[model samples]
Target chain A: MKDDVTIINCQLINKAQALKDVSFEVKKGEIFGLIGPDGAGKTTLFRILTSLISADSGQATVDGLDVATDFRELRKHIGYMPGRFSLYQDLSVEENLQFFATIFNTTVEENYYLIQDIYKQIEPFKRRRAGKLSGGMKQKLALSCALIHKPVVLFLDEPTTGVDPVSRKEFWEMLKKLKTEGVTIVVSTPYMDEAQLCDRIALIQHGKILSVETPEKIIAGFPKKLYQAHSENNYLLLLEVRKNPEVKSAFMSGEYLHIVFNGEADETVPNLKEIGPSIEDCFVYLIEN
Target chain B: MIIKIDNLTKCFGDFTAVDHITFSVGKGEIFGFLGANGAGKTTAMRMFCGLSKPTSGEGRVAGYDIAKQPEMVKKNIGYMSQKFSLYEDLKVWENIRLFAGIYGLDGKQISRKTDITLKRIGLMNEKNTLVKELPLGWKQKLAFSVAIFHEPKIVFLDEPTGGVDPIARRQFWEMIYEAAEKGITVFVTTHYMDEAEYCNRVSIMVDGRIKVLDTPGRLKDRFHAKNMDEVFRQLAR
Candidate 1:
């Protein structure tokens, strides 16, 4: 299989010891996910791969070029959208896109076909200031600017964190289209639900990779049988369920209390029904015992 | 009822920010106000909390007329936002104490309640650290604890769990439920449809109007949708 991005034991020990022995590979035309919490070092890894920051140890390559040796050429083949909005807020949407294009020695018209699908969504607001755009509109504009260079590998970090549900759904759809166009899209999100959209995901926590598997396989590996109990008082139900020796762990999930039984024993709570674990459940299980 | 609103409406020039939306919040109930961006949910909430003046109609929050007695309403309710306002330079314990002082809590009361709060949230060790030194999850939880430290009748949270991971979000919801058990009304706004399930009742707004208001189960069944996300999509469309 052809790999568009590869990392080998990347380590960084900046302020808080960000990354440690992190490594992952993304195949060409695949949507790879780095899923984790806020301090999980996802951003640090993206920076190293994008040639913004050099790793303390290990090596990374983008599109078959060494990230350290071919740093200059590597910059042209990659586009990175940082965790926070990094565009010129004072400039209009079209101005931001044109600025990035000019810096890359290219023009928006030159790469019109590359970012046409994304650009057209926000084209109506082309004259509006970037800062005045809504959260979803700002994200779309940032994505359009990132693709203005027509790079091979696209890096998106927590693009939909504060966006509404409808916009989040639409953003994922756009990413799926980009994948079909042979762009190796690497995105990171704290929301496990978004992980399901990626072709493959790596669950990271505390600067360490917990598991690397497809969303289905990861959930399938949840060791114990899970059950959901709905009682009048969910908080009380959580306390009561945890006190049971037969229960391994119990946590409130939305309206229901999700529990993992110690073993298949009798003494089931009334109205207890078996359920499947979601990506978040699997992530919690992987992080803890 | 902890809150009572009748024909609440607000306008800016020729645009109506909130239409004649009438609703009441029961004491100790977890009420969810959900909507897409640019919807009137925020405006309605602002009216209830006495932050914005309504062009017409009236409401009483905590038995204080929102229009006539905005000061009393402000004193009786707690408000926390996604962009939490905390003194980043101050230590965690100092921030808590500062809020306590603002609410006119005696030193003894402040010490006792904060001790219990620290133990409850498992943040005893972090009390002496600067607020900026804490992680995002911990900081959010701390902000919530301070918001309710005054023990107001109703707590208004604006997208309280935005950008938080699932684990922290789950724990945050659990805390909200625990507060509800103590007869403290929780009024919150969020973009997350999943969080709406935990509310005793939810209201969705669109274009300055209340589109639907009901329990999560009933709303889903009525709209013939599997989840609140679908319900919202159907309404927003």
Candidate 2:
């Protein structure tokens, strides 16, 4: 089986430069995550590679088929779940699955094994209206519909954005299972913590690639000593700590504050007690410096 | 306290949309109501806001019984829907004015509140721009600002940050904090787990019932999980 999925010097422009010289590749059977905030070019890149839109500059090939030239063949081999729940809301759950399968010149029974685990969750509600199923169930139905044709490559754009936590976990587990079965998956999300779930991730910001690496490597490479600090007048302490000489960055991680220090934690704590530091300290540090 | 709900239950054609859920919000609390899509959080909020009637139960918001004084309840609370609720054909200022009028704000109050809201959302320059022309984030901010244009005692926000950027989401929460500080109870619903952690307290609903409610820290500890994501998983299982 062909392994390389390459995008080189990709560029696209509309209201803004949605993507700027973006380049990346996904190896066969690997889950590659495109991690970034909205309008960070994740969806734009997905559109280009899926042949839904053409990039003004740069080229991409998936499984040795040119995205621009082999549109029909590429369409047949890639499954895409858009950010929005774009299935036929008017139809029943069963009808939606049957419709997607038919579009690919296949039948649900033909690929039943591939979608069995996901489909079973919603099978009891097969007669229920697509719009009537709970959010988690809707997510499962979408996944089943996407996989009904058993595409070699899967592209999901923020699929878990509106899904509940349980559904999100279940979806990720399904992706891992599919990867083991040899499907190359490219998923995009703005959730920073989810970056760790991918085999490799590219952190994109403002249409540019900020960093790309394994999740552990990226966090380990974070350049400053981090500490969780809090005190009375939490907001005021955060402001004061940010002004301190030794404090590098501070951000809110739940109720406590994560403060990055330029010096030793022990030394910094004593000095910070005189002033104070809060979670906002890290966010200010990231933005200012 | 600005809002109180007791045994609130809502049903549509034999299906319980919200089942016997009860909660209350203080004057300045940022209360988060969480559930999967179609999990009944929205339905509960609607019943509280008096947009939909409860099948059986009682609710009081801003000193008005939801069933007996829905108009009074509507006059005292604001609502922003998951979908953009502003008229797309109308200009930004026009949308604000329309909502203000709906809440009975007249003349100077409408103009004054509209100006403040426009400036606060950093959309003062786009006051004349049509809602359709604005980006999703801008539209969301505008919808939120419009919802609270009358300075209601309680604001119900349904998935307010649905499709915006992290930066935009951060900014939106900042605005929420500002409102909460001014003693307006903020009732919000979202499926985003990370965002759920920002609330003063969060209630997680599953299968039309509230399964857990507490501060994020306590919920994490109660579920013996590292984060809200795991907490939800444990409870869901």
Candidate 3:
């Protein structure tokens, strides 16, 4: 597959390094996720790659165009939905979409097909002010506006951070449909569960990439034997498990405590059931190690 | 009960945001409030926190009437929102002191509590560090500690662990467990399904009403699901 986006040795420093030697490549028509917690420099990398800001050093290219010098042309072929709500609050949903289309030298009707699925959900409130819409409705409007020009690449920063479970599922479905249309997506999110939806993900922390691989590969790479220690009092169990000398890491995992042993198992802890590690476990382990 | 509500409803003109929701939370219980976006969770939560008036309802939070004694309700409860709970410009100790004062603690008590909180969170050395300079996890922990600094009968946390890391998130939960142990009722809302399991009981709201309310274990069995995520998906769908 052809590379749609490439970031090489990107570094941004402002008193402290926002991104340190970040490097990655996104293949055409693939969903690439930059997974990390807040303040992990996902936005910084997105800004540099989308040509919104220049990196202090290193190179980035989108769709064969240089992010620095060919930014003006690049802007036309890429859509960016920032992490924060940046749409004009006073503008109606229809007006917002129209405004974005006109600024891109296009019309809503020109590329209506691109945003038709998402736009239909919010079209009933087309005349309502963007500010009056609910969070989910506003998100739909923003996505439609971003796609109005039929951009080849879409950059969504934490699009589902606060969205509920069902809405998040629907949003990911929308992304899948967009991928079928060959729109390469570069998304960043703090949710580890969402990492599985991407073709590839880079686990970033403290402005550095920990591992870049498919979700399954990352989970497979989890080093220790993870267990779900079932107990009536998980909080107490957690504290007790952490006190054990053989325990590597222990934390609550739903109904049970997820504990990882260092080398050998401790028979004293009853119901020490083994389970596969999730991307979240891998992420915590990578960060600690 | 720390919180009791009956037929609580909030209407904005013709649109009903919270539709005759009725539920009660026991004292010292960790109650999870679950809902989809625009599902009336925030609206209902605001009424519980006394930040917004209910269009019509009968409710009591921390033994104070939500509608008739909103001030008393506010005074007896601690509230924190994920978006704007702390001041970025203030130092760690300054934020603690400021909140403690607002909660009606005296100067001496504020100073004493500030030191205790910083030490508990292992941020004693960073007392003068700006809140913004601290990591997001630490800031969240500090904000939570400050929210309950006055030892309010009940504490409301709105999506407190939104983007926190796994380790820090568990640590935050530990703090909540400790508070609940100290007999402070915890009312928390979160989108993370795994967190739902930690709650003693959870109410899943849909549209504008409480559709399902039960313990995670019972809810999973009733829904015939493996985890809270599946149960939530079923209710949300």
lDDT of 3 by residue, B63-164 (tens): 999988889998899988889899999998899888888878999988877888889989999999999898889988999998999999999999999867
Give the 10-residue window scoring lowest on summed lDDT in candidate 2 chain A: A274-283
Off by over 4 Å in 1: A15-17
Which DockQ value does candidate 3 get? 0.67
Q: How are the candidates ranked when ordered by lDDT, highest leading? A: 3, 1, 2
Candidate that scores best on lDDT:
3
How far out, in Å, is residue B125 in model 1? 0.6
Write the residue-wise lDDT of candidate 1 on B11-101 in tens digits.
Answer: 9999999988888899999999988887887788888988889999889999999998998998898888887657899998899999889
DockQ leaderboard ranking? 1, 3, 2
Give the range of the ten consecutive residues with the poorest summed lDDT in model 2 chain B.
B162-171
Query: Which runs in model 3 stand beyond 4 Å of their true positions?
Result: none
The alpha-carbon lDDT assigned to residue B208 of candidate 2 equals 89
List iRMS (one decimal) for every candidate.
1.2, 3.4, 1.6
Tens-digit lDDT track for model 1 on A113-155?
8778777888999999999998889999999899988899999
Candidate RMSDs in Å, in order, are: 1.4, 3.6, 1.5
Binned by DockQ into CAPRI classes (incorrect, acceptable, medium, high), candidate 2 is acceptable
- Clashing residue pairs in candidate 3 are none
Question: What lDDT tens digits, residue by residue, belong to model 2 across residues B64-137?
Answer: 99998999999999899767589999999999888888888897989977787788789999999999887777
True contacts kept of 1: 0.60
